[model samples]
Target: MQTVVQAAAWAQTLGLPRLEAQVLLLHALGRAPHDRAWLLAHSDDALDTAVQATFATNTQRRLNTEPVAYITGQKEFFGLTLHVDHRVLDPRADTETLVEWALSCLADTPSPEVVDLGTGSGAIALALKHSRPDAQVCAVDASADALSVASANAKRLALPVDFHHGSWLAPLNGCTFDAIVSNPPYVASDDAHLAALKHEPLSALASGVDGLDDIRTIVRQAAQHLKPNGWLLLEHGYDQSHAVQTLLGNQGFVNVQSRPDLAGILRCTGGQWPTVK
Candidate 1:
């Protein structure tokens, strides 16, 4: 039976990245990173067999280009550790920019009602709710499987959010909100990224040929769902900001603008619905 230190060293020798090696080692020992030393001191034959099995699975999946988050079924976003799988797109740091924008918009509004369209793993909705406990937050996804994952996350985090299984604004037909935010499928169908994105749900990543299909639909429809003076904020591809801004402009939204992510990429665009006359 190999000790935890020995197993970790072996995984590293397999050419796995340093962080991945640590994760695999922790999985092999059936312990978290902090517990690795404790498991090493109590190792036995049965534990060794379990460790070997886990290592094989982890190594094989990594070789297949599966994301470590999907492999571990977890991802961290907005300082929150979220449970995730292939059913939903893994939350990325770029999307945090949208959350920060939402928080800023909500700052002046009292008890704002926010809707997260196409919420996956409830990352946006949950993060918003966590920040503004008094705000009314609702999230909807077209995929039942994704909704399930999001619901589970909401429950685990004890964050209150309404989860619905339907496409776009279908579930909230008669409802209106003070703000609407989403990181919709902005990747074009012909995008080269899809080849590497095969491990994730296709429906959650790519849209129509131009990749603006869903974004277009959301832009046109969101105006109706938003209250007077409410805002519609969306995260799109870095290069798609111009197109998204155009879409928001044609929809008659005021104060239209795009914000850059930490990397200075135009990542989010938003506009305010005009107050009724």
Candidate 2:
């Protein structure tokens, strides 16, 4: 048994960054900050082994450029904690911008049907369903492994979302929605980020040479699945806003616009499908 302060100090002595050390200690103790004393009083050699294992895994993965989410097997998005692993893309806080925008768009629509394309870890779909219990939310992913992880998360959160294992809109054939949102693979194959992204599944990150391949496909096909005046929102690379806006405009979307993230980067682009003429 050890105190929280002692465990934190031990982690720091192991060369972990301050935040990582604290987080690992919290996880190892199986106790929240308030339960620190209880955990410390009952800690044993098994607890020490578990803490050391976590520290070694995180440190080695970080050294190898593996994302912390992949190492920790979890990430927080839209104020909800999600289980994550190599099978799915780690949910980023930036993607919450899309969720917030979607919520606003659906505010006046009764029981809006929303579809999340590429629903890794079910972050977007599950979060939306959690917030709007009446909404009919469905998520699709090309990877069955990713969908399995997403399904587990949905069940864990008690959010009822339809999960489909298929690429893009294949599973949504003849299905229409009031809104369609995606945080698709928009990284260019040759981008320097790929060097660091190698730890992630290639299909989950890189698109085509221009990085707009998946974006282009989604824009092209989204109209077929959207109800009249439906909204389509996407999170993209910081530099792809103009191109995305053009793509949306060319596809007859109206009010095409890009929203800046917390960093002021134009990270999300959206537009409305034209109302029937």
Candidate 3:
């Protein structure tokens, strides 16, 4: 005797974000996630017992602070619907800043070779491959489970990307890329925000105490792997631009610059690896 209208109203009473509640409800009802307008048009429609039970379960999960993307098992990033779960961190729209900057760096180069380090869900690598089919794309990650998720995404999207199983820049011996990018773990070990991200894999969300451990690793090693004039783009915490820019400069990167995200926060930093350096 449960109805979609009643369920939606109950969700509102719980103070759940309208979009998250509807997404969970629609997923429970086996409807498309984008069909929010459909729900509005048919709000009065009744749902069967089984559908109601399923929706209730999802609503409770959301109430417990589970991410809507994790509940739905999919996140849209850079025009691609990426399947995500606990095995990988949910791709964030903010990370698209790195992808956009990477594309700009490779715009004039023909058949540019690109590598995404610590590619959690293959989001960055796949988006680069999808947008520039002529470019050769490679994704490297240390977690086998994460690699499996990313590999599946690449296959499902029919995007050809070389998948490597190892830590950042480890497996690509003697291989150089025209552009290297990553949205590595930039959250500090003591950052208060880690509590909110409890469900995500910590290895993919936190680095050393300063949160720049991995960035240091990537910047230090990039000089050897990057072709002359190659670019390295990374997404970091909003307040770490100055620190990251200094790291890039210390590593011999020139024309270093930080790009502002949609919120005007300098969330991404990049620089060119000059041949003379």
Candidate 4:
């Protein structure tokens, strides 16, 4: 009979990081993943046979290249605990930077309208709604399955974001927003890093040959959807900052700029649509 401490340590041997092991173990015990301190305090507590079996299954899933967030079915982003699964790309801490930038753009505007394209799991839209309750938030996705997951998240979180199911900007035809933001598919189709992320949905991970295909589509269409002087922000590949900056400039966006993520990598770029003369 293995105790909580022993089971967690053994899980680490399965090639999981220490924190992943602890969080999964805590989840199996019906404890919160962030309650690692509780696990330490109850170190000697013996896991029941059923609990051990569940943890073993979760360990095997992790070893099979499944993401820890998917195994646990929850990811914390922007201080919001979001429900995530295989239907959408998992949210990352890096995305919080885009959300912060969007919030800053809306700071002076009362009840600004914001739209998140390719919302995936509704991480960005929900975060913005949670932060600025006065903002009218909307999220759009191409996959109906992904939209289902995002809608469920909104319902559970009580953050009322209008969910639309269609390609980027398609569902919101003729609708203009005060700001538009997205963390679109920016990974190149042939990127080697994709091998490590084989478990995520391919459509949510890869774009076209140069990984800027979707970004190009967004830049072209965003001009019509963004109100004059409205800001458009996008999270993109770390190395594609220059390409993205040029794309925005070519699209007639003024004040074009790129922002570095938490690690100082230029990860998000944005610009403003001009006031129509």
Candidate 5:
């Protein structure tokens, strides 16, 4: 029988990153993924035969490019532990840039109304609600399956984010929000990156030819749903900031600009609806 350390070492031998190997092993051992210190303390503890087998299986899943969060069935985003699966796109840390931006925009407004469009796992909406409990947060998704996953996260986290099922900005007609945020699919349908992301839901990864279809739709519809002086923030492809800024400008949004992610890439862009006219 392999020991805890041995199992982790064995998976790394198969080309898995050290972090991925440790997470998978911890998962197989029924331990918290973040419990790396436990692994070191029990490094020499022998794994049960069943646990070793499970570790090997999870190792192969990683080799196949499956996301570690999906295998472990949870991911930590914006200081929250969220349950995730293939039914929804795995939440990325970079998307937190958009959430932070939204929070900053709403900081001065008491009990601000906010909506997260394309809330795959309700990460954005939930994070906003957790940070600003007084804020009224709503989330919308086009896929019912996605909504199920998002809502479950909300229920588990005890964050009362209102969820709606419909295309972007469609379900809440006649309702206006202080801010609207989204991380819509911005990958070109023909982009080679899709091959690496095959494990994720296709509809959540790709847009039209230029990959701006969903962004265009949201920018067009957001004006109608946003309160005067409200903000519309979006997480988009690495190189699409200029195009996104232009779209927002054409929509008559003011204060258009982009924010860099942790890596300093302009990964999110936003603008404010004019308070006048």
Candidate 6:
């Protein structure tokens, strides 16, 4: 029988990061992902044969560059534990910046109306609703499959975000919001990094040749949907902030600015729709 410690070491030998190996091992053992301390206490405990088989399969999946969240079926985003799978893009920590910025905009506006475009996994929308319970949050997704994942997460978290299925702001045609936020597909279709992201839905990753296709659509449509003085915030690629800010400017948005991600890379940009134009 392989011991718990031995199994983790074996995973490391196969090139998984130490943290990933430990996380996958704990998952296979049916323990919480954060139960690393338990592993140390039970290092010598024999891993059941069934657990070992599960670990091996998940380890190979990780080796293929599949996101750990997909293998485990859950991801922690903005303090909410969301269920995820191949149907939706895994939520990343950087997206919290978008949520934070959105919250900041709505801080003084009681019961502000907000909408999230391309809300894969409902991470941004859910985070906003969870943080500002008085806010009316609506989320839109182009993919029915992505909506399935996002809505499921909302149900589980008991967050009552109005979910709509359609491209961008189309479903919210007659509605206007105090804020509209999106982390749309901004990866260039031919970017070299796309080769490493084969496991995620391509529609949720790549935009046009320049990666600004979705951002442009949002900036153009957002003007109609946002109330005067409303905010439009977006999370884009590491280097797309300037271009995104320009799009907002051309669309007559004001106060355009960018915010950095955890790594200090400018990852999010936003502007307020003019109160007068």
TM-score per candidate: 0.89, 0.88, 0.98, 0.98, 0.99, 0.99
Off by over 4 Å in 6: none
For model 3, the run of ten residues with the poorest summed lDDT:
1-10
Q: What is the lDDT of residue 127 in candidate 2?
A: 87
Candidate 3 on 205-261: residue-level lDDT in tens? 899999999999999989899999999999999899999999999988999999998
lDDT of each: 0.87, 0.85, 0.92, 0.93, 0.94, 0.94
Backbone clash pairs in model 3 (N, Cα, C under 3 Å; residues 3+ apart or in different chains), count: 0
269: Cα error in model 3, Å:
0.3
- Quote the positional error of residue 41 for candidate 3 in Å: 1.4
Worst 10-residue lDDT window, candidate 5: 1-10
**Which pairs clash inside model 2?**
none
Model 6, residue 197: distance off in Å is 1.9
Please give the lDDT score at residue 75 for candidate 5.
97
Number of colliding residue pairs in model 6: 0
lDDT of 2 by residue, 1-277 (tens): 4545666666567666766665555565454523455545654434466666665566655656677677666787887889999888888888888999999999999999999999989999998998899999999999999999999999998899999988898888999999999999999999897886667888998999999999999999998999998999999998999999999999999989998888999999999998873
For model 1, residues 215-257, the per-residue Cα lDDT tens digits are 9999999988999989999999879999999999999999999
Candidate 5: lDDT over CA atoms? 0.94
Off by over 4 Å in 1: 1-6, 9-15, 33-47
